[model samples]
Target chain A: MDTNTPLAQTDPVISDEEFSRFCEFFYRKTGILFDTQKKYFAERRITDRMHKLGCATFRNYFAAVRFEASGEEMQHLVNQMTVNETYFFREDYQLKALVDGILPDLAARRNNGKPIRIWSVPCSSGEEPYSLAIYILENWADADRHDIEILASDIDSAILAAAAAGVYGERSLQRLSPDLIRRYFTKQRDRSYRISNDIRDSIDFSRGNVVDPQFMRQFRAVDVIFCRNMLIYFDDQSRRETIEAMYDCMSPGGYICLGHSESMSRISSLFRPRKYADSIVYQKPFE
Target chain B: MALVRRAAAQIAEDQPSGDLVDGQERWVADLASADASIRRRAAHDLSQMPDAVPMLCAHLANERSLSVRSIILTGLIVNKSPAVVTGLLPFLGSEDANLRNGAIEALQHMPDEVAPHVVSMLADEDSDVRIFAVNVLAALPHPMVPEWLLQVVLHDPHVNVCAAAQDALVEAGEPDVIPALEALADRFPGVAFIQFAVDAAIRRIRGG
Candidate 1:
């Protein structure tokens, strides 16, 4: 057996050229950019799927990901790669800022009596969007008076399904106080908690990606967007393109909240920083 | 492989430390170049320079190129400086397994140098760091592997960490490990996998 020969490559390991080709193909399909730093992680995940599908080589898997009509393999690959480590009220300060400052501003500026729409991109397993709904229902006096819709979306269908199910483990509710948990969740037999119907029903959960230009049109005129922690994984070009698309998706004077580690300043100058009592958020000013 | 080793040794003997430093500095500059290929080539060149070992260790913390980081780890492993082991200690808790495994492989080359650092890493707040430390000790033929493995198996709070330690103990464990496994089984009655791993380690230790 010739170990060095490309024809003899039966093991799951991907060559540098194969990885680079996959990178280009993947980025074009889904606006997520993967640099060299993610090679092993990408290979391991792609190879895992390939083995599951009984594919012998990475090239074969790449072909399936590119040419497959159903797009199931691509979705499986994205689900494996995207990190979804979020908890309820994960960044409480920012949530507090939204409830305290942003909501009132949006309420005062209402024109044509339109309902306030909030979107949570890459909402993970329902934590961020659910947290937003809970905060609004609990804190805002006019939350019931004004028709508010919360749309939570992610590219990974598996996570969207989990979000729609509204059941979460103990780890996902770490920041939620016992009072909140008791009020908002029903205890399951398996020790996990199912979010209350009131909270779950408020969110319109769907599978959508920010990089997909066609899908982002539904989110136009949204008053607030909580796209936290997702942009840190994006490459520079992807970040710029995604942010611009997000900008287009927003209503004038709409607010965008990124993860604490993510910043719009480097990515785009469209959204200006607004300092709240405890947190810094970005706002699209009325032009 | 022998010829390559000899050639590397010959380069180390003949190449001036000053020239190696200049070459390393140029490569480090190239690491930040606009072209990804330039960055990759620089990382490859630096990995071959014996004098560039410490810089390679330091650069691993900042290297964004996945291939470059992997190559730099190979450089650090081949050089086997105590500084390399210590430098890699902080990366054990990295979410990326590639980065964590790179650190582990580098430390495996110089077990004596890594011994003191491993003790501190075992006490790290992150259980993943402790797991990686145990994994390094398991890979090397070090005298400390069995004792540390037993300690982690008995005391680690995280079930996954405990499982990893017991997994390592399956190979390196002594007869004394049997009693420790029995005690661990008692401590975690609910975790069936832990019990299974404990049983596997005990059987291996008893030479059953």
Candidate 2:
């Protein structure tokens, strides 16, 4: 019943019936690889449903959730199964580096005064791209009149919904400021807050698959592209291929910001760390 | 959290523009005797600028709108300062949902300093806070996280909160907590849905 424990191979921790339910439920939703080892806990989680269904075993519970689960059920499963521990400004250091340090430099180069178009690849639950909107707003306060655009995308539709709605519970705001909270959020209730229109209108939300060429085709030249935290999940070859594709999509002299512990150091020679005294940033070399 | 923000926004938009940017500096210099509203106002105003962390941190312990408090935390997150976390750790025990959420969000942003505080919240009085704590703890890779996981289940007022806690406990494998799990089961017995989890938790704890 306790899924956290490895279903004992010898003793059979979870009945095959429950394991099948979990595998089907999770895999159908997230496409993750769940082996037998996850059964003890996964079965434990689903078994309670069986009890309610009055089916005493994991097998009965499996069938019910499988049958009852709708599109939303699958989305709920995907949301819970995947680790989406996002906050208001998750990649804080990188964002500040982009706004205070990086954007100013990039601003100097754009002689045509065309608005910078930025994309947040795999922008889960809108927080990532919304953060980008807030970032650019802070940097180029004059950006309102310019062509600056930010597009945030993610494959998971549930998170995109949360991102687009911009209604965050009090829980989501710990790292945010009272002032920013006061200025940017409208109270929904005693417990919930909606992000202000200034931040909300700054972003354009869409559903996209980074791995798909058709999905990638819709994206185009940008001054900066934030594809942080998504690259690590892919195989090396895919990462390399995606990196090359992203390079093509970026404007000449454009920059990309990766996850905190990640780098393009060995990944590609097309981009180099634009060394700065305050923080290290990367820029696409002159093509 | 939401109420504070609406109140502050009115103040920010309506307040006559003055040289109050330095007024925030003056307020923080004393950091004492300022009323809650003044402190709340000052905290909101200063957060507009880049690197408004110190002012945000000043309000870390005080009671503000969870929304207002969240704004400060966002500033801290934007700045990536671990120092703000040391003062924030105690709020994990506060009875406010926003406080707990702020603690969680803060810890998520500043793990190096905030991890230990999250660990302590696992033993909090409120089951909702504990449920969130277990979720936070389970997210981490540290050994203490799994250890805290063993004691994560709590019997509380809300059924959904109980279910959420049970879900987290089931994932963490808090087998040794079977009695508590069973007690929660018995207390809320006939719910039918949760009994198996309680039984399984007991069975697993007994090595059954």
Candidate 3:
């Protein structure tokens, strides 16, 4: 908490006593290997949390945080470690690709016959799926709406409630055209807007993990799965596991999505990056 | 904590503000260098800027390094720029709640602009973001903030958000917050945080 704590004191040249607690604390908690090899700039992050919580020192906060059984302190710790900066429909290109290339292809593949279910795995706060639902409802016909389903899932149960409600302010909806708002949204109040059932019904709000075996059911019949931006958190093994799982559940000629920077070529030969003019989507190999 | 301690030590050792700036400039130059040690040192040095609050706010978006960004958040609430908050407007719909919360936190420091978004966050269903939005309303001035805070304080799923809502109500009260808070607490006794929050808000509202 002392404002006097200099940055150099936080540097690698520090004595063993100064930041050893943080070195042990973070490395143990996240398995993020924060030793001499990496020289992770931990003093500021660790100490800042200590100061904010009024724990006096990193050592004190570390003891309380490391020993805690339930995840509150641990969750707070992870929150401190991560710098979350996201907005709704952040890469319009990704969803735009869905509206143009992915949806049409899926609809045609169905021969306008079967439901085109899409899953936004780890759909925190509903933005991803709601955006997906909105894209489908607005660009395509509600008459064709029976053809698509978006199952939005997240590991966090608490965030799912917010995603289910689908309310937003003028800011969250700033990019949204007013006409689109009028067509696809139900105004909850002067300050709020909720996606109309026309869009919300396409999303089956639920809780599922990208890790456990239980998650396979949610992806059972997905034609196009847009799992963007969540892969950055997974370790190699889990990433491979999830990629395999997503591949397994993909219906014939179904597609898969990942964060813009993620690639499927490295994961498996079964998924060929579906090259389009403006975007790169992935498709399952035709059996 | 080390930053505070080390800054205190450097204050004892350093020459003048201009020299510090020169040193800071050098560090900034090396921020993206291929040398790992230099990058590490630059990150360490950057975390110590006395004017870090304003400087870090300016540099926040440009910095690609997560370590540096985390360090920026680590220091005393810098990046308190109205611009930083405004820039985040596009990201409001981001599926990442952490990003949403960061934007919310950045917005909290700018009181005039803070009210509108804080109001928006109160209505946000994500309990964490809603709770954080309530916290921003706590520090700044918002008349409507209380009603919304009390509403969530009584009902939110995340205990922390409820606590923040209760605190915001205490800081900035509305006429109906008291009765509504009391009723909510009475209805949801299971939420001990809400009950405690109601007690605190009611006590404060009665002008305690």
Candidate 4:
């Protein structure tokens, strides 16, 4: 009731019960799971949202999130809770699995002569699809033997344009070795870098929403998908729908690499979990 | 052979022309197509039609292809209604584990629609059906989930059913449910695992 008190000071603390309740609700709504270790991190965001909405208590904020018909509050909470940072090779272990394990299996299984297609949904600013291209060219021994098509898509058209522009700052290129950087990038005067035109031009970048059946239908016979970290933002039904759409587009025996935190087992039983390199990738069974 | 860029137009050209058709009757008819892929595509498309719910639910029983069955289940989830819940409830008693589990998974996504039926399911005569109901509660996001689990713990005669509810309670339970969980240990005395699970649920609820 102290109006003059700093909002932070007056904000009702999220109790352990409230946190547990919130975590379960959040996890069920969005696939992202927050554990005990993330208690402070989760509380900070919840309180921030509560403050923004002028809700003085966690209970009221949660009620609005749960019962609000428009789901506008839930969307706001999702944006606040998600970390959308992307950089080249953010989780390269899966990339290692791709060139080492996934590609070879696909190559061996291919009897039909067609291009090996890989798709990166929610490609963000192109770090992931670009990373896929670099890794395949540098590592896959059969890269020349197969015509590979790299398709990159994101729901954000602005990000798709940025991905098409193929520029990055020093922070985004931190994981690249100096030699790989020199080989693939032209140093910009502003101290940023632009990826080589060959790499950039070879990737087909487009705007796509993974949950849209119309957009998802455009992709077919995809051999591998790097759909990492994107599904964590979707509600349960959307997540299930997206995964099923991905299943339909992919070639049988094709592989899907989700974020390290994401699990196909939790979403659907369609894919078989396969361990490759240090990471586990889910594979569509050969029909 | 090297890295190549294919235009989205070309990618679209590669798909079968049959898929481009979006007629309701076409898709409904395709649901019975001999080709599993056609059936799957029909199931996927029919998800957008509210009236397709009954047909999609009907297809689940005869759809042998796991992929097609999965799509039908998704269609049912997309069109989730009281009718969808009623359609799926029979699967709780199914002899097919996959169908039963798929129904449970689909039901979990519809908390409001499924909430009305949970109590009756928990009170079902078959212990397996009661356990399956608990399985649905495990991932269900309804606020009443904790109360439902507490009811199962205190009153369900089957230990396996109580155990399933206790496991779900670890995430959904509240401090008030601790008494029932404690009493659960007494209800199933000499069952070492029951005592252990009850203690675990209590610790989790108490935030220890």
Candidate 5:
């Protein structure tokens, strides 16, 4: 089999039916759904994989994906399909909700004197956890009245190290206003800005995987969690396990903000849907 | 008060009490603990045990807390086997909606293990069981999902059962299933919702 076959000349064309079949299979495997709009994108990636494998037809490629015990090909497809760009305040409506709605509710209901804990799993490159800190400090009037502990984690140790280092390029800071950026970050010699030492020091950044039960066990009584865009890469069982683990670690009435495209109702019945401001979040039932 | 740093020692203080050395028996015993958190932890630990499926499934029935029930179901899903499916199949008939839905959700994740049972489940005398079987197929990743759904739409006498199949076929059906879907609409002409659902399924399968 010649692996260098030109994709256009020799690659088997994917029919609409095959595209639908592949989308369903892919969605089930990774909880990431592709619609008709993504047909071109999906077909291009799949056919590229087929060309590299020298599979003459979609059927042969799909058969390998479905029946292969090692699932290496499937992982490659997942990597091909997912987009992982991150920046500060990319989905800031949820941040607005966090300051305006979620925090006030949490603060009012809290009788315990313990510090309120907010966790950000898979906190890639520190933008999200740092954004949470800046949002609360700048917007929430009660920020000075309550002790807040921000915990950030990621499965990649290198990314976790980067998150702890709290440095960012201009692209990652595009969404921040100049005033807020000036307040929270110090301009570095490299023309990048490093988040202030106080904001960086306040967060406890650690390496953790959501699907690992032992790793998930250390988090307790968490008040809020920003676990966005991470679960879409996980298969069904892992997604369920991750949600259930988060449930156990969270305090009752605690809220979780998933990526806008992700829905808790699709994953588990453990959390009730709570709409705050313009964003929808899931809340652990107070039972 | 302001943003505060929690020491690593403080985080360690939050770890659950039981250790791995507690043995399977201790974890099994803790499955019945009055504390829901302890029961949840026991379920998490028991997921590692090879033979803990039956215990977890049994505990799921008596487990009152939704959190514990979720953990028990996750344990069942993680340890998915024919036995796990057998333990969960009964829940599809459960009067408790939560348990039934939870069972359906868990079964969806174990497509290979649940495949052998799909035929019996879809052919069950209970119309609700048949509907639940279709519900399972709605998300089950198996390639045979479309064929199983077509079987339900073509032969099932219950209108709701056929409707359930049509709902699933909206996503799982191929263009070949369109004729069967049309025939289904013909089979239940008097039912407006059935006609509507069948038409929608046909349009969707056709990518209209």
Candidate 6:
């Protein structure tokens, strides 16, 4: 139980068989691939958690992860394993495309008085969906004319709590212009900043995973989905299933946006690729 | 292997190889001395020797003292050798916070001499390595950086990797990169960040 045990005294190695077990367990739960090349990374992250819990080997830790009574340890493990680095106006051009290109087109096609609903899946710490709200309020002249709803969701409950709290450190504000910072965020006494209530209240935040079909089915008529940079973690099957789910939830003719590196052609043929002046996006085919 | 032999031969021809060996032995022993002060001081002094990078990195595995590991890590940071980056890879997820941070910091700041290694490390299994490689790419002016970053933005599995690549592309991407960026936009239809990163990169390249 001593924290000061010498490196030689502690066993830091993970056997190939042990590593495979971890990979299978991870994929079964998350649908993300953990290949052999990631053996070094996988071993080390597991070792870190193992060392923390005083578990001497990968097998002991695996058993704890699998059989932990409350599942809190499992949640913590997922939290530690997943990376969530995001900021405001991240990939601002995509927002520009949505505002300048996609919005008007969707508006033009609108019938009845239905609200324009946008979902930001895995909306880490609220920066993304809030940025969307800020972008519309600042640039879209038709903002007030339509009923707008922005729903932000993520699988990590810890980050979802943070998104709900809405406080941010300086690192998260690096991409924001001084004007936007001054206008939208109030400086806190601890040097962190809190997003304005106007932007904060504009979003409906929840904890959900895209991999679950049932969880995804809870939403209907999503007009535009901003699920940027999340699919890269998914393996081929996971990616296809996720894309299919997004496709099903979207209203006919609704739009979906993915990470710049994510290619829908490789994942699914359901969404039609559309080119705008500044960006390319996918649209659900009208029935 | 050939490069290390060449470097070693060069070092041997320039100095008394026996004296160099003795000095290295002394430092290695000092790194493990019972006196905390001696261990700390030796690590700090040894880290300043670029030639000591390989040895320091090797010592990192068995070294138990967080303070000593941290000092050795700092020494590795100054080592411009591609091998040092390789040596630091295993510590990316160290249980000790300081060790992990030090390893990442060292790899992050490696000089242009190791730029080629950084490019290859972009595909490293560890996301931290890829993330650090992109940060290094941002500071490098190598001609291949932009395109390499574009490819990563388009293909890396981890969002952090893609994010870093997009940021680097925004900083250094050129007009030649526009077509590829546009193609990527089409590939990932709904991804606003990718499209935005491409747009921003193209705008900067065109002086917009």
Candidate 5 chain A weakest ten by summed lDDT: A1-10
Model 5 captures what fraction of native contacts? 0.49
Candidate with top lDDT is: 4
* lDDT for each residue of candidate 5 in A186-246, tens digit (9 for 90 to 100): 9999999999999999999888788876788688889999999888777667888899889
Per-candidate interface DockQ score: 0.01, 0.01, 0.01, 0.45, 0.40, 0.01
- lDDT by residue (B63-115, candidate 2, tens digit) is 44443454455445444545566655555566776666666655554545555
Chain B TM-score per candidate, please. Answer: 0.77, 0.48, 0.50, 0.90, 0.91, 0.63
What TM-score does chain A of model 3 get? 0.68
The global C-alpha lDDT for each of the candidates, from Candidate 1 onward, is 0.72, 0.58, 0.59, 0.86, 0.84, 0.69
**By lDDT, is 1 or 4 better?**
4
Residue pairs whose backbone atoms clash in candidate 1? A36-B66, A37-B66
Regions of model 6 farther than 4 Å from truth: A1-84, B1-208
Per-residue accuracy of model 2 over A16-130 as CA lDDT, tens digit each:
5435536744553234546778544445544433434566544333334433312233334433344547777886877777766677676777778666677787888777776
Q: Which runs in model 1 stand beyond 4 Å of their true positions?
A: A1-84, B1-208
Kindly state the number of residue pairs that clash in model 6.
Answer: 9
Tell me how far the alpha carbon of residue B191 in candidate 1 is from the true structure, in angstroms, after superposition.
Answer: 72
Instruction: Evaluate model 2 with DockQ and give the value.
Output: 0.01
TM-scores of chain A across candidates = 0.71, 0.68, 0.68, 0.87, 0.86, 0.71
- After TM-score superposition, what is the CA distance of residue B29 in candidate 3 from its true location, in Å? 64
Candidate 6 chain B lDDT trough over 10 residues, lowest sum: B1-10
Q: Which portions of model 4 show Cα errors greater than 4 Å?
A: A1-43, A46-81, B182-186, B189-192, B203-208
Comparing 3 and 6 on TM-score, the stronger one: 6
Task: Place model 2 in a CAPRI quality band.
Answer: incorrect
Q: What would the TM-scores of all predictions be? A: 0.43, 0.42, 0.43, 0.87, 0.85, 0.44
